[model samples]
Target: MSSSPQPEAELAKLRFTLEAANAAMWDIDLVANTVVWSENAEQVLGLRPGALSTTFVAEPEWIHPEDRAGTLTALWEAARGGETYVIEHRIVTADGETRWVTARGGAVLDDDGSPARVVGVLVDITDRQLLAERLRGELAAKDRFLTTIGHELRTPLTAILGFSAELHDRLSDEELAPVRDIAQIITQQADQMVALIDDLLVAGRDADSPVPIDPHQVELCGTVRRVIDGWPDEHRGSVSIDEGPVRAFADPIRLRQIVRNLIDNAIRYGGPTITVRCWETPIEGRSHLVVIDDGPGIPSTPPEPDTGVHPTGIGLAVSRRLAERMGGSLSYEHVDGTTRFELELPLEA
Candidate 1:
């Protein structure tokens, strides 16, 4: 058999290899209260190796003031339990730059099985911490942007609707004909703006919690009729609704907004006649509210604002957003030269 190596010589080799590694290494003698740290510790803790007589002296002193208490508490708990210490916290470097670090360590036992020393390793995690913070900031900015757009759009829309109503009330029959047409156009555009604002608000809210609305128990048919009645008789396209009272549990106002947007978009971009069909079907233990429109279909390519000319408006985008907020979906396809827009909402129980 080969001769066994001396224990002291073998330990020295292991220590040398650990010191050469990049990670910060440390040891604390519990009885003597003395501490030893590798040269790499300076890079992690901003302190020279062996700078302080005791590890506790070097702690709180170099650690970020805000993190000192929590870090000490965790470290002390691990030490008392005779277990490894593992923690991540912010630290101030030698040059006064803040960074994040992860530390892992364990207790060393004496011959009597009592805790004698604690040793550990540390790794820098500053880059990963910064990246997480950046993502959170970006999400907050998006929410603020949506809220601002809704507020701004609502102001102009309210003014347009109020003024149009006033004009409709004051004009004489002969004078009212032309004024009524102008008022109708204003009202239509105002309604479109309102729908857009509602979509933004609902999308922001739904980002937090989503709940399904019942479409079979709500008054959807009445809401559709009211929207059609608001349109001007001359300029309004011929609208037909199949007979029957359709009920859905969705927000009545939001449902009306979706239908109004689809119908308005059809008239603006497609033909003069707009047909709305409401029907319910059971699929996999759930009822669905289907609204189909025969209009110019959505282009396979995504809609662009400055496309010069197209048979689609932003209303489709708003409708899709509203449908999703109510836990439904909107889809479009073309069949036999007719562009069809479909809104599917969950039917009431």
Candidate 2:
């Protein structure tokens, strides 16, 4: 075997490794109140070589004012025989620019089992931190835009809905049948627009939180029937339901949204015929509604990497979220060349 490496060679190797990783080594002597830094410490910190401070106490001046106290406290604790610590804080450069850095350190003990020095490595993370901040800003801006547009659209939509309803109620006589039909159509379309805007408003809010809902006793079959009836005449002919008397404690509006979205997905992506079935499982004391279609199943693989595009569209996602918020769950499966979406809910006693 080759001779063991000399101390100088080992130090050179360590310096080379640190340089490759864009990090600098630092050591603070507790008893002497002094600090030492590797040759590249100033360079890593965006300062000219030999310009870095050597005094242990003066190091906090380089740290951002908001983070100086916490950083100093953590280092002091580590030097006082505390456990190893890792901290990410902002550092201020000589030119008043702020940069993020991650520091990791531990105490080095003397023979008496007391910390004699605190040693650590510092790595620059300014680029990564800035990128994360920019992304967050973009998301906030997008949410604000969506919320504003949704509210603006809703104002006109509400007026349309109110006028259409008033006109429908006023023209109930048989002689003005054609006008009443047009008014009814306008009312239905405006109501659909309201639901769409509501979805947009919800999307503009924080997604991690569950969708808000108000739940009450609901005649489940009637809700499902209303969603089916709302479909256009042409597509409505292709849909059928096995309507059983089922009661559920749920948000009727959101329940209708879920049902309508499922049916719409089926009509768009599924086969020509669609079937909906609702029933209560006595043993489980829960109610379930299943929408089945004979169309091709969801694609086995996504079309593009990292693109979370659902095969059917965003409606399924919204419907599933609403179902879960109302103490129910929506799930999908493909069996025997048939695609089935099932919604399970708590049964109203």
Candidate 3:
């Protein structure tokens, strides 16, 4: 049978593990004003082995200038029976290079309930800090590119739509039927481009910025009908509107956008059958507008992480955001072989 290892052997193994993890254990004596470090301290702190002087007073010099005062205050507070000391800050190594580290420790009290010492660990986190900074920079660049492209495309689309409308009005005579058909097609395609540009602009803005809303009393049935009628003829097939009309206190423009996006999503991914319904709930004077389809619903699991594009599409995500910004909510449910997306809004502002 193998014998159990001695205490000294276990200590050596623990020191080896800490060194491999880019960490060092430390102990500080309050009364003696002295510090003791594991043998690997020099490696973690970017100094030659045996070059460090173990004194509590010398620690502040190692901390970055901006973090020195806060670090000292936290240590003093921990000694006075306060919370454990935990901080992530910059440190200046002996090689004159700045690095990020997280230090965590707690005070050890004596029999009289006074702090006699503190023990802690220092972990090098320079790689993690650098990675986070790079991600932020990439996100900012994406937002700027989206905003610029959205504005540029919108300018030409607006001109194309205006010209198409003018041609349609001037060529209304039966003799010019072929020319009028071409103009109508141009207007329809231009309208779709405008909607896409709106989504891009929304994606470019800061998420916390409030969406601009102008609310008023609006009839839900008419708004929903208008959006459906605007769809291209082929995409409008197999859609039926249920016969109850409801009113809501909401932004008409945003309501139209939400409705259009939902219908487009259903047409792209759902089964042939589709229905739109509107009704007032019995309690709270709230109303619901739902889009239903007979198709296999979205997967139970969430979309994959870090993919940028939503699984269903960006339209549904934008619709959900707009609904909440207008004091409403959008939810989804898959039940009894049918998928439903419901939007609820107040009857009064």
Cα deviation in Å at residue 180, candidate 1?
Answer: 3.6
TM-score of candidate 2 relative to the true fold: 0.63
Quick one: best TM-score, which candidate? 3
Query: All candidates' lDDT scores?
Result: 0.69, 0.81, 0.83
- Kindly report which residue pairs in candidate 3 clash with one another: none
Model 1 residue-pair collision total: 8
Candidate 3 lDDT score relative to the true structure:
0.83
Off by over 4 Å in 2: 1-21, 29-34, 46-55, 76-83, 107-117, 175-179, 200-307, 321-349
**Which lDDT tens digits does candidate 2 get at residues 227-343?**
777555777889887855787889888898888778878887799999888888868878898899999867665543443436445567677777777778999999898999999
lDDT of 3 by residue, 1-349 (tens): 9999999999989988897889988899988988899988878988766666677774566789999888777877887873588999888888899999999888999888889998889999999999988877776777777767888998999999999989988997899999998998999899988997787566455564445789998877778888888566777777888775688989999899899888877787678988888988747878789999988776555764863547656677788888888888999888898999999988878
Error of 1 at 221 (Å): 2.8
Which regions of candidate 1 deviate over 4 angstroms? Answer: 1-125, 138-142, 145-149, 199-217, 234-237, 282-296, 303-311
User: Which candidate leads in lDDT?
Assistant: 3
Q: Which runs of model 3 end up more than 4 angstroms from their true locations?
A: 47-53, 72-85, 109-115, 200-256, 263-313, 321-329, 334-339, 344-349
Tell me each candidate's RMSD, in Å, in order. Answer: 8.4, 6.0, 5.6
Score residue 47 of candidate 1 by CA lDDT. 62
